[model samples]
Target: MASKSVTLAEQSPQPPKRLKGKKGAKTEARTTQIGLFTVEEPEPFKKATPAVHISAKNKALTLVQHKIYNALLANAIEQDRDHAGTNVGLSQFSIALTDLVDKVGLNSNNRDYLKGVINSLIGTVVNWDFLEAERGEVWAATGLLSTAEMDRSTLTYEFSAKIRDFLVHPQMYATIDMRIVRAFKRAAALVLWENSVRYEGIGQSAVIAIEKLRQLFLGQEGAKTIYPEYKEFKRNVLTPAVREANEVSDHTIEVLEVRQGRAVVGVRFTVARKQEAPRLESVDSDLLMSVTQLGIPSSEARKTLGRHSESDVRNALDYVRAREAKKGATPITNVPAYFRKALAEKWMAPEKSSGTKKAAAAPGLSITGITEEEIREKYRASQLGDARAYFDELSAADQAELIVRYNAWQPMQKWRLESGKKQSAAAQQSFLSWLAHETWGEPSTEDLFKFVIKGLASTATA
Candidate 1:
């Protein structure tokens, strides 16, 4: 038996999508120009069609896994676009594990499950060009990921060569909005959304066999075992997927049922891009850093940001930090919950034991005979020394992991990531300095003054 192959003439032509915005449209895709290519913003990440149609032998991704993969793809494409003039291709890509969980509605503090997801991708076989008619003679079968590992707080991964090439340059792909992906609770809805969005540029989708659609959303075995009857599959899975696609996706999809004398055989989607494009969401970098520092995921933080003003968010953070740091202050077991309450209710600054908030101490003989700034600089230096010593003591593997993280922090003309990559001595030294400073953290009023107060005590004794 021979599989049907699609000839060039057999496929319908799809012109490039128009980028021109209509009058009164709120937003278009936010993009960054990188040499010849314009990299789209991460929210509406471009997903390769063939990769999305990975063989049903591979189990359908869990909801978290689905989000993780989308986020990783977004980052990969960004790196690809950014590395335009550079010699390095995508040999091994790295992303802050925190960023992964932060954007995908996962708890950044709980990473035990992420390790499992990475392992599964590395183990799953990717039967590329599985549908022979899709690509005609171009096919390769390999693990979905060539190599993947969690190096402390960073995820370092590589796609198998052929897959990597196609992924980075998908001839035809769908741009998926991450905000929408975050809204999906079920993997089925996500998979359906992916399948539907590819047809977004065109007004409607071509007919798809019912069995293929089922297996695409729920692995082969699941399609067979879970929904034994067609009506049950339609009622439980297809209907909800369509409803979710309409609610959260960029399009409103109406499924056209294909039937033979009332027995359904296939379906096609009539999709229309939403009238108003989703605005590019923005969050203040300073406030984002503050929120994530308190064990809140970035996604959750963004929701809070939507509800409050920047000034309010900053004040709430200040109150939380002050209340937590005061002597004999009650320990907050749940930082995120506490911060949310503080922000929503507009918590006022906590006072010291004297009933009034402590005033900033100016340069004076009574206050350690040193200026506040001077004491802060000395304290920072001490922290830097401590961080340098701690870094030096780490095992070679651990230090290397930190370097990988530094390299991932792109927009620098330093490291070259090639096969058998090596870091330049200068680059290594630069990373050491950065790590020390990062460990030291930016000086803040409460934190810096707290150190100054302690330093004053030691100075008085001297």
Candidate 2:
């Protein structure tokens, strides 16, 4: 035994190889399944105000209301798909209350809080109007979760058939990340996010009329009484929502105000996908994809975007895209140079003033020997002339009605200013609409505002 040393092969046994499956046997492969979520009838649903519960009270949907409604829609769609052979528009389904709570991330322990949310969902009404075959059709429906009953820990619910059809077989829909929705703390932010997703691939900023934006935020009701002043609305609603969306959502949105004279009449939101951490292998490839999206040459976009963060580069691309989308935005003659400048300078928003300093310097007192006050006088005269021209365009009836409405609104304006209260955009629109209908027989709100501005300018000059 001492003379014969053990060989290494005799001391150890090799582990058995993983048994290969029989030929033709099913084998698992590494795969990633991306979940696709459906939105209820795409366009109308995206644009339709989820302002339930407060339409009667002139209020919009609260954050909780929005969350619950979306949760129901998502859950219904998922359940219908999960059960094999189930009808696509099946109205009835059962979900655990706990599951609903968890999905919505509701933290309250009180059962009634949940009950209140459910009741509100049952009472919420959503209206859809869309174009089909070049013809406009309207569908009015109430109660997102129209029917429901809770037994012990489980809840049974039914969605209206109209809603079910829209959700199950959506003709127009946007794929959304539910995680992003869950992260939004404000309803306006969520609405904006969804709208952005809906219009993601269009290569243009989504233009929402100021009035429509109001409705989207406050529902029909809340839009009426809240944030009467544009400044107040911007401070309280638009700015905050946009900031939150930029911080938390998958897209970066920048707002552009479309103005008539000094008043903001509409807004354009430029949306672009936020760039993720660069993949070592695909950085250049990803850059090329962005170039394609931006409608720029691959070599150019890379040179421009390479120096900036992915987000900064995408934002610059979006800014250019938005300009291209505008009706008369000046075309860029030099694409590479423009991209370089835009990305380098981070031109997210349009310039507020152009060549003002140059114009002011052009009229220098040293050259003309004219005082600054004289320059101011000349500008005032020009403005006054423009105002008079606009005023001359108004019908006599409109002129007369303006005096009346201005007088009527004066007291209200004074009261609001004195009390430190704000007039909401809705109230302003209502006043303008009423004045226009009374005087001009149903002119547009924009026209009415123009008339009012001209009239007020004339009065100040007089």
Candidate 3:
């Protein structure tokens, strides 16, 4: 009998088409179509405690771990509507390991490294707290990924049902560039980025009490006694984080100290987008060389040049040099100070007339006997004495809270001193005004200052 002939269709079926890697290893199915979904923006307004708990506490996530967690959340949110219920945890999705590696901007050669990150993420346990009807509530859960498995070259994970609402259905969220998140090496900077991004359009300035900031960055179980010295804290934590954000991210941040008398109470940060790149001019090596010759440090000169236009620096340098050339002119005792003042004030030419000897000097600096340094020191001492008196008048808890605020503010003051800048009176008054409002309802600015320093002598005593 003739055997039935078998066709190719009746034999083995072909595998789905997949992109190939360098080694010809099969990757996930390639899709040329653009993805039409919005990354579920994280709700920045939600108390940062939960995010901090997940990101910083319980074995802080490595860069890869952070990226993977984010990637899962983004993918889950994109597929949320397609799944049933408000729970992203109920929705399961699979991402090709190769696709994920590419999306996170990682090298595909190190599959083992990616596996380790996945394992760590699966093993992490997060603890968080919530308020239920004015009562404290505690909740503990596993990492963001509830279940994860690897099949072939695909990574499959489900979002934690406990955090589903917080992750996807946020009341208010921040739309951050994942590219920026991937670029951050330090966890502190990423935390700060999230904190600041939420307040982006609300106002140019954002203020966070020191205690809250600590909780946000260090987590609930982190050391309370750490960063005891404000200077150490600034050097180790604040400056580096702020610098990274400003350098790589779209936002420009200026940290300001909020003082209550002589002690720093908090920080006020002004965030703004970087100005558009200005029209370029031919490099003025001559001006830079002149700035160095005029006793400005080369590093400082370079920074000044970068900040101001060459024409501006050149004009300022010319004015200063011309003044020095005058026969009777007092040689500029502080060349760096002069250059800084010139650049700051945009001084192009000498004043037409020396109406008064005092007028000839820079606005803040003095000509005859006193220096700006002396004036600032005197003002600082007075402010401190006033703050101390006000601090003493508060109740125990209030005083303790004020001390925490002071701890936060001290670093900022030290930063200003190290940078050769003085804290302005207006900034101090703003802090005092905020304090007064917090302490005893709202009061007029004059009333606030008067109450804080009432019955105290004006004399500054160490």
Winning candidate number (TM-score):
1
What are the lDDT scores of the predictions, listed in order? Answer: 0.61, 0.51, 0.51
Residue-level lDDT tens digits of model 2 in 199-290: 44432344566766776666666667666677777777788778888997656777889998998988877655555322223355555566
TM-score of each: 0.50, 0.48, 0.45
Superposed by TM-score, candidate 2 places the C-alpha of residue 349 at a distance from the truth, in angstroms, of 40
Per-residue lDDT value at 332 in model 3 = 66
Off by over 4 Å in 2: 1-58, 84-89, 129-139, 203-205, 276-462
Ranking by lDDT: 1, 2, 3
TM-score-superior candidate, 1 or 3: 1
Off by over 4 Å in 1: 1-42, 129-140, 276-462
Candidate 2 residue 83 C-alpha distance from true site, Å: 3.3
Measured on C-alpha atoms, candidate 3 has an lDDT of 0.51
Steric clashes per prediction: 0, 6, 4
Please give, for residues 352-379, the per-residue lDDT of candidate 1 as tens digits.
2346555564434235467767766676
